[model samples]
Target: MTVIAFLGAIGPLVFIHELGHYFAGRLFGIKSDVFSIGFGREITGWTDRRGTRWKIAWLPLGGYVKFAGDMNAVGEPDAAWLALPAADRARTFQAKPLWQRAIVVAAGPVVNLALAVLILAGFAYGYGVDRTPAIVDSVIAGGPGAAAGLRQGDRILSIDGRSIDSFSELARFAQIRPAEQVAVTINRGGHRFVRPLTIGVERQRDRFGNEYRIGRIGIASGSPVLAPVGLLEAPIAGVRMTGGIIRGTFDTLGQVISGRRSIEELGGPIRIAKISGEQLSLGWAAFVWLVAMLSINLGFINLLPVPMLDGGHLFFYAIEAVRRRPLEPRVQEWAFRGGLAAVLALMLVVTFNDLGAVGLWQRLAGLIG
Candidate 1:
């Protein structure tokens, strides 16, 4: 059941991502040769009236759409496409105007992001957010909040001049700004005052032994309040949530790059599968949320300015726009090769981290001993 649930979660995302490219190509009058939901040997397939071969392949990890006039999934132009008649060449992806090609390439990531927003909006409208007011129920003795003269029943109005809508917001703000002194505004008995509190920092480890630092103010909040979202406001809330996730992802990546965060925090397919199975066990709502988060991750990752990614293609297009011509094929080929190598290296590292997190190596060593 777990395996099934994992597939159920990943398959649709891959399909939708490829579908975005396919639809965008068709919209620009470009022909598609294949729309595959996986790599390697085909498990099942059917050809459509548009001469597009839609197929399910053996590997279920990722998918691609092969456009006409392309040699492969990487969007390399084919020599045979150049040899084609003018009428047919006009229908090829590479033969399209630069703007059209750019749109077709960018459509995949855009659709993934849009899908996340739509899913989140639907969830918000159906089941309102579980929120807690930014009111302190208790402050730990001798902790940062207590030391700063905070007391029970104090309503937190803002932190560092940023207005706090809920306790979760306050906690998130603190978590990311560990060991920093922040100006917090609280309303006590109809009077508001600012308090300078240096947030305490704590290093926490998860079940996997992955450690990260978080800020602590030693404040507790009351029970959650169900804040109902109206249909009209749901989409706006969804966009806001998606933007927050994207910002958080970049911040974490920046931290990892800057040595503030451990590289072991990175995870690959194994971690995704484990998370999906756990979310499935939790309930439908949790699984849906996982899907939404994964969609955002996918979209953001593809937009990274690395070769062999949509962002890479966009980067090249920008150069073409400025220079008024595409880069030489050889240059593009070498760049893509380097990008592929980098991607493979990153994947291996993340996979190793995932295995370590699950204690696979430790279990293997135990068995051998």
Candidate 2:
């Protein structure tokens, strides 16, 4: 059941991502030769009326749409496409205007982002929002909050001039800025005052034994309040939530790059599968939320300005627009080769980390002994 749930979570996302490319190509009159829901040998497939071959392959990990003028899934132009008669060449992807080509290539990630927003909006409308006001119920004795003169029942107004709506917001803000002094505002008996306090740093470990550091101020709040969301307001809330996730991701990446966070926190496909299975056990809503989060991640990763990615294609297009010519085919090919190698190396490292996280390495060592 866990395996099935994992596949179920990933398969639809891959399909949706590929469909974006397929539909956008069709819209721009660019011909596609194949639309596949996986890599490797085909298991079952059929040719559509538009002469495109649609298939399901053995590997259910990812999918792609092969445009007619492309050498492979990476969108390299080929000899066959070049040799096509002038009449048919007009329908090939490479023959389209640069803007059209860019749009078609970019549609995949855009669709993923849109899907995430819609899914999150739907959930918001159905389940409402959970919130806890930024009120201090108690301050830990001898902790930073106590040292900073914080008292019970004081309502937190803002942190570092950023308005705080909930206790979680304050904690999240503090957790990312350990050991730094921040200006905080509080409301006490119809009066407001600002206090500069240093956040206490603490090391934490997850269930998988991945460790990281977070800032704490030794404050606690009451139970969260549930607020009902209206029909029109749901999507607005969804957009806010999605934006927060994206910001948090970039911040974590920045921290890892700056040596403040460990790279061991990064996880690959195995980690995704484990998370999918765990989310499934929680219930359908949780599983769907996981899908939405994954969709956002997929969209954001593809938008990175690295060769062999959608953003890379758009990056080249930008150069073409400015120079009035495309880069040499050989140059593009070499760039893509380097990009592919980098992507594969990162994948291997993350997979190794995932194995260690799951105790697979220890089990193997025990068996060898």
lDDT of each: 0.89, 0.87
Question: Candidate 1 — which residues are off by over 4 angstroms?
Answer: 130-133, 147-163, 176-215
lDDT by residue for model 1 (1-369), tens: 567777988899989988899999989899999999988999999999999999999988899999989888877777788899999999998899999999998899999999999999998788887578999998999999998999998999998888888998888878876777889999999999999999999899855455678989999998888789999999988898788779778877887898866798799988898878878877899899999999999889988989888989999999999999999988998999999999999999999998986789989999999
Candidate 2 structure quality by residue, lDDT tens digits, 107-196: 999999888989998988988876888999999998889988899989999988888898877888888878878888999888998888
The top-ranked prediction according to lDDT is 1
Model 2's alpha-carbon lDDT is 0.87
lDDT of 1 at 123: 86
| TM-score of candidate 2 versus the correct structure, residues matched by position | 0.89
**TM-score leader:** 2
In candidate 2, residue 41 scores what lDDT?
A: 98
What is residue 233's positional error in candidate 1, in angstroms?
Answer: 1.6
Residue 330 in model 1: lDDT: 89
How many residue pairs clash in all the candidates, one count each?
A: 0, 0
* Deviating ranges (above 4 Å) for candidate 2: 153-163, 174-215, 367-369
